[model samples]
Target chain A: MTTTNRQVRLAARPAGEPRDTDWQHVEEPVGEPADGEFLVQVMYLSIDPAMRGWMNAGRSYIRPVEIGEVMRAGAVGRVTASRHPGFAVGDHVSGTFGVQEFCLSDGRGVTKVDPAAAPLPTYLGTLGMSGLTAYFGLIDIGRPEPGQTVVVSGAAGAVGSIVGQIAKILGCRVVGIAGGERKCRMVVEEFGFDAAIDYQSEDVRKALREHAPDGVDVYFDNVGGDILDAVLLRLARGARVVICGAVSQYNSTRPQGPANYMSLLVNRASMTGMVVFDYADRYAEGVARLAEWRAEGRLTSLEDVVPGGVAAFPETLMRLFRGANHGKLVLEVAGGKGTGTVIGEGGSR
Target chain B: MTTTNRQVRLAARPAGEPRDTDWQHVEEPVGEPADGEFLVQVMYLSIDPAMRGWMNAGRSYIRPVEIGEVMRAGAVGRVTASRHPGFAVGDHVSGTFGVQEFCLSDGRGVTKVDPAAAPLPTYLGTLGMSGLTAYFGLIDIGRPEPGQTVVVSGAAGAVGSIVGQIAKILGCRVVGIAGGERKCRMVVEEFGFDAAIDYQSEDVRKALREHAPDGVDVYFDNVGGDILDAVLLRLARGARVVICGAVSQYNSTRPQGPANYMSLLVNRASMTGMVVFDYADRYAEGVARLAEWRAEGRLTSLEDVVPGGVAAFPETLMRLFRGANHGKLVLEVAGGKGTGTVIGEGGSR
Candidate 1:
């Protein structure tokens, strides 16, 4: 067995957009699993826009990553060794394994995954944390009833795509707000959105008013900023705005403050911020439902897999912030073979 | 039968603080009740700060009072002549009867009050709409759990006083924010509040920090502005901020916006604006419970009745905004037999 493991570590916190100088790549001999711990070689790593927020030095739903720590991320891997009773060698698992070649886990929050149920990378995308986030945020927090108009920003991305589709399944009139015509069309045609607004070419507020003539009942906001302000103007009475992420403001040199929040008062609406980790107790329910939808072909699982080893960690993660990935942006660390590739079996890898 | 009746009509919209020119006093003959309508002789009129919001020319929870309309107000009056099946002559009733000596109602949302259960004026205070507003705003919207720290602004006034006491009944550590030490002390002693902050004399943020070191779990806000901004900074995780009214901003010539609303994001809190009219259907449950508490001496029925007939209406109503009212501010409109007496009876009416 190979003794060395490559990992990406945060060298310093960035002021705005993270630079390569902010990260340090290091290789160390892989250590054996201790009692009640298991060792897994990471197969895929999840790159989320929220990772930028986790790098900031401030109080949030979760603690920010400290300097010199392995950059925190979610990963799917194959357990190579186990000293814990709950896991064994050859078992497929997923957890917050960080941006590393191998991870050591005590099974605190890690769970076993079945490749036969979905693609291995889907555990990091549509069937994983992203999927669960959209599921709980839209269904529970946003609480859109049938015939209600549901608007989703960042609608082409992993979380937003699932959110819009779920609203569609609930018999809502779903609208997607994305950057360009191509992405907007994909969301409406492929994801079953009723309408799509090309935010790059249209005035968001005007476009929203046209698409949602009755005003927006639920706004699943993944990219907050001016778009959020635009949506605020068109909110129906008793509208619910679910704040899943604020990707548009993540790279701002100064804090991006919302300008038109008083609309919440005029419309008697509410804005609620949510983190999926808060619903950890009910994650199985979300996972089971998402998995069933994918199996029934009602939900499409999309993953933009960047084929590269641990060296591509930093670059692969940036694709999410750049809007370079149409689907879930994940880094293929170890070989895709035997790591679980059921959903990606007939697709180009 | 009275040969003439007096009424106060909105003469003009005020630019800022209302003046004498904004209202016009007119005399007219009392008309007979139409079919399905009843004639009510106004007795005790409720002068709430919310009246200021109604005068504004914009869409709100309720429609704006037009220029020529009689000034809208809630009044507890006696039915003089009844043609409506639901009501009869001599019945004590409460409705949006407008500010006049005589009012006509068609039995829409009017409730008959029992003078035996409580005095007619009490029907305009603790056991009426004010009581229901405090009950639902605290329990339904704020959702204060036992052992949680609950805070309320406008603490000495009608709704705030009831809110603090209701929180106490729910086993919460209640804090009140009022303008002066007198009202603060009254809130603590009369309403069972654990502490009270004289926001005008002391720093609200500092006081809240010291009083609720664990942070505020629920904030029932009647006053919004700097006090609201202060409370925003001290919210506990998953805290609920109930925006029942923004009395502080009602008279501002320029709109006052909350500067620290981002605290909602940092604390994962929620701020919900609500109007009592939304819960009109469930008002009976609230009134029933409030009356029961007053009967058992568990809840203090506080009323600050300003005597002098209908001529003093404008001046008496101003007392609410000036913090001159120790509890509910109801006008003694006709020199009734029970003038200047605080009705201690407990029940509806």
Candidate 2:
């Protein structure tokens, strides 16, 4: 057993894309649970595109991670030690445990999950923040009616994939925009999108016109920049654009804005930004609905569980920017395994 | 009265700023109206910033003014000849009469205006489309609560001046942003804005921070360029941005998009586009309320009333872009009355 916990911290604010030097690897004595506290051994760390936003030294939806602090992240783990009456050792839970192998928690925001029912990695992605983000942003903001066209950018990412599926379940004609042929194929065949546009190879504008001939009614924007501009021109009358995340602009020092925003006026449309945390009160309702769908086999939890633990946090995050991950990209603690490959890497979930 | 009508037609599609060559001045014989139509002698032509948008050959809220076609405009005039039962000679009316001396109308979209109640130019500006735009955009989209900080751009122009005044009447702290010292002064003193920021002289972001220290609750954006970007950064939680017009970008080949739009996500805010034409169903309701306010001394109408008739349109339109016009820029039919200036030329409409 390792006596020291290895953690990744933000060493400096990144200018563009974060390099290896931007992160600092430090080792400290494993923390113990204090009175009314519990210790969590992080098993799965969520690798989200929004992580890039937290590294920036600016105001955002949430506070930026300070220099020399453990990089803020959503993680699923097991309660190893506890002095709290509500929690016991060996209980599975999830919270913002950060980029660390061990986390000392007071159970303030921690949620107890059943590892036996759903995999631990699933809790870090589909059943967690990513799922809630897709749920609230699509249902509340996007508000896609049946027979309407719903377009989602970053189709293979954690939140976008779920957004497309949920829109599909609601009877919307779903079209996804993704980078590379593989992602485009996965977006359609795996996630059940009506169609997919390979943004890397195809003219996104032309592809959008072909896929959604009636125009996009609901646009769940995971990637901003040029994609947002392209989608703006194709909005149907009274379209609702959910500005959920801007992964493409996260690393950009000079983020591009949508020049075609006048389309909103032409179409009488609205562009609204949503933060899933605002729906904290409705999280249990969201989880219950998502879990219900999962049990009924109407929903599939997709996770690309990569091995390397907290030390591999920097490289794993790059996978999102590179569009290398197939589904929900998650990193877990290395247990004498250095495969660096996705576990259960095929078929639906 | 002249028997020949001098008309300005679109000679070419403008690339950036409209030039003299973009319009072709042609003289045509005045035509008589048929049984179902009425002929109008345009007395007051509305010279709006939106005219620049109509010249562009692109998809917008309204159809672009085609090359070689009569330039589009809103005008208030008296019916010279009426073959229709609804319209009689000498009846004061307002409609899309175009940039011409005489217009033939079917009375389909024409509305009767009373010159006794308000000035004829006011029917083309403050009590017309510009006023309607301000009313619906502020009350419907902005929905500013009492004590909320409401900000407006193009404050000395038609829509923005009215927007600021309405915000003040609604019990909001209103701040105006306009170009140059003169326009800023007019926005505060003449339009009754709480404070005014001269975009050309002051740092807009800094001025916003100082004036709206609590952050802006509602931002009525008449100019959408760098100023829109500046206001986006200073938005309070759940701020509503009303995208009424982009007077700043109307002449640009490549309109500058707001680079800091992500501030929308940071503030959980919304940017919504509004076209006054969309509220055609509620125009009477809006006009009635505005008229009531005017009668009670709670609201005032403002118009520059530049005299160049239709011939002075090209130059008078430039006044809006040059920040020359202090209020609603209106150009009546060339009455040969030299020394063209405002009608009232004093405090409040």
Candidate 3:
């Protein structure tokens, strides 16, 4: 039997902001699984700002996604056919399954997810890569001690939201910097952040000074550029700045660097950049803890799923760049049948 | 009986390079100790690049040296008159006694030095602040592991010289970047550095690339600016760059920063600045390790002493800025002494 799969392919490299011509939706036949492979029907696809970096043809922590290849992404799906020993036919699996309706996997770096534990879309958010990135970057790289002031940028977004919550769990005074007032409120109310700064309404530097009077001990930087510059000025002595992602500058033609980095000298601070893939061997440990937190009702997972045919992939993913998504943005490819109900405000499934 | 003492005071803050007009020499009658204070006869005065930063009218890791005050410096001296219980007459001690022939101390942050263990100048160099700065900055900040490739800038200077040697002891492949060929040769032969790059004669980037072909794992940066930019381009993943001092930009009217800092993101590395004074509580740990290395004949201490009266303090201290001194530069205040033989190029003591 032949299965039809709609895939998003990279048609051209984007200079600054990605346009319609940059991506192409191609319909292809999904073949049967080979000897050692399994066939998966894609249920939810993770849309991340890191996708912009993968479009560029340069060396980074990870290799860029090649041209004409199904646009690389993380997805949670149900296995339809299995020839692999570890995976069953009805098992829920997540991996680099690309932006497609169906995926064939050889079981390399693929993991099974439980629907009863939480929503299936959450496996792509809180209990997935975004959650693991926040955990290791804050806990291991930042190393925030108890009672230390922890500041997080992009605080309303998926990774930043989890990072702020983890800092709070570590007994730190948590402050967040988000784009709007609504997002700021969500950061404080949902994530248990002590204070929030709306970057659009308030002057970040002034708000930071008022909130973090003793200066920031750990800055979990997700949006680099001017926000990073503002945080640099408010860093306390021996501060650790963890650079997880630079979403604000990822789509810029010319990336703007921090102007006042010399503050690192006066503050005797350190700025470290980390890629979550580097901690791949220990990802299970982070996922286990995050799942436990969710089970205990200590951590709330937010996922915004847009339900439509696979043709809506480009526009759905663009919502993240426009700051339209308040949580982990996921595209639902299989409709509402097998996929669970969407519970959040922006969710439609 | 009245004793005359000579002191060098900061006349004014210099604009770019400090001139002779920036200092004033004054002679005053040395008073006797009060209740607990002791009078120290200054012998060896340390002249460091960090002194330039102290003269600037801005906040730093430490407070700026005040105008019209005695020029600040670390000095090794003998207690000529004592009333303090911790110190006795004829005891050798080291502290921030300034550029003076005598200092009155109540034993705050002052430590006794055994001249018989090593020369009095050795206490100001290998056994004192410079040695401790190198020890902690390399091991604690740089975190060089065994078999890692470690690079050190200003490698022939006081702190950098010791940093390269300590990295060697940790089983790291040590590379030194120095100004002249003579200093480069001395760094390899005396400090046991694996290789030395003549930054003055050769292209810094090319030489660094050749010396550290596999990329630098730990970079102990004493000279920042362009050398830091050169090292940034060749950093390995998870590399640690320790900023101990910025000697290259110390005298600049407007300090220039490294342009290639984006390499930190690409390499997933960290750059941290450190001040040795912050590790004051653990200074004895550094001193003991350095002393043990010296005793085992594995580490050699180099001191270049300029023999003159306290009136020559201004000119003697300028040798550091000019890079005229090959090793730890110290001023020997002339007074009642035995044969004042200026020994050149000998082992420790």
Best by DockQ: 2
State in Å the error of residue A176, model 1.
2.1
Q: Note the clash tally of each candidate.
A: 0, 3, 0
What are the per-residue Cα lDDT tens digits for candidate 1 across B1-349? 3646788888888887787888888888876778998877788889898888778886666789999888899988877777888887777888988888888889887889988889888888899888999998899889999999999999998999999999999899999999888898899898889999999899998999899999999999888878988898899999998888877777777655565555676677887777788788899899999998899888897888888757777777677767788889988765274322212112122
In the order shown, the candidates' DockQ scores are 0.24, 0.67, 0.36
Error of 1 at A112 (Å): 3.6
Q: lDDT (0-100) at residue A163 of candidate 1?
A: 96
User: What digit string (tens of lDDT, one per residue) describes model 3 on residues A150-251?
Assistant: 999989998999999888888999999998889999999988899999998999999998999999999999888789889988999989999888888878
- lDDT string for model 1 (A30-126, tens) is 8678998888888898999989978888767789999999999999998887888988777789999999888889998898998787888999999
Per-residue C-alpha lDDT of model 2 across residues B1-349, encoded as one tens digit per residue = 4567779999999888888999999889877789888877788888888888888876777899999999999988777777889987767789999999888999988999997898888886778999999999999999999999999999988899999999999999999999888888888888889999999989999999999999999999998999999999999999999998888888888888888888888899999999999999998999998888887877777888776667777888898887788778888683324113212112121
Any residue pairs clashing in model 1, and if so which?
none
- Candidate 1 chain A, run of 10 with poorest lDDT: A340-349
Reference-based lDDT, residue B241, model 1: 89
DockQ of 2: 0.67
Across all candidates, the chain A TM-score values are 0.95, 0.95, 0.95
Output the better candidate (2/3) by TM-score. 2
| Best by the TM-score measure | 2
Docking quality band of candidate 2, CAPRI definitions: medium
Cα lDDT tens digits for candidate 2, A1-349: 4457889999998899999999999999988778998877778888888888888877777899999999999888777677888877767788999999888999999999997788778887778999999999999999989999999998888899999999999999999999999888888888999999999999999999899999899999988999999999999889999999888888887899999887887888999999999999999999999998888887777899888778889999998888898889989783223122222112111
